[model samples]
Target: MKLFQKLTPKALIFWTIGDQAGKVYLGILGNLILIFAIFEPAKINYARVLINS
Candidate 1:
């Protein structure tokens, strides 16, 4: 009911973050690497991708 609806978003966000931690880390790493490799971007590591799936 209303309680379920209220918790849905929090639960979803938690699960999504948990599931995609690696992907997010890799994506950020890739982005930072590409930037440095091509455009001399900053060296940044570790990332948290938010997924709503």
Candidate 2:
């Protein structure tokens, strides 16, 4: 979670820079990739744990 907290700011900064550079589509794609790679798995694992519990 702490790692995510740190990464969130960095990601936001990068996304902002990308957007300012007129790479909006690429920024959105990158955000989606990050969401799936990081958040989606955590969400699935949390749901599984809740169901098991």
- Highest lDDT: give the candidate number: 2
lDDT of 1 by residue, 1-53 (tens): 87667767879788788779978999999999887797543222222222322
TM-score of each: 0.39, 0.50
Model 2 residue 29 lDDT score: 89
Q: Which runs in model 2 stand beyond 4 Å of their true positions?
A: 1-22
RMSD of each: 16.5, 15.5
Best by TM-score: 2
- Lowest-scoring 10 consecutive residues by lDDT in candidate 2? 1-10
TM-score of 1: 0.39
Count the clashes in each prediction.
Answer: 0, 0
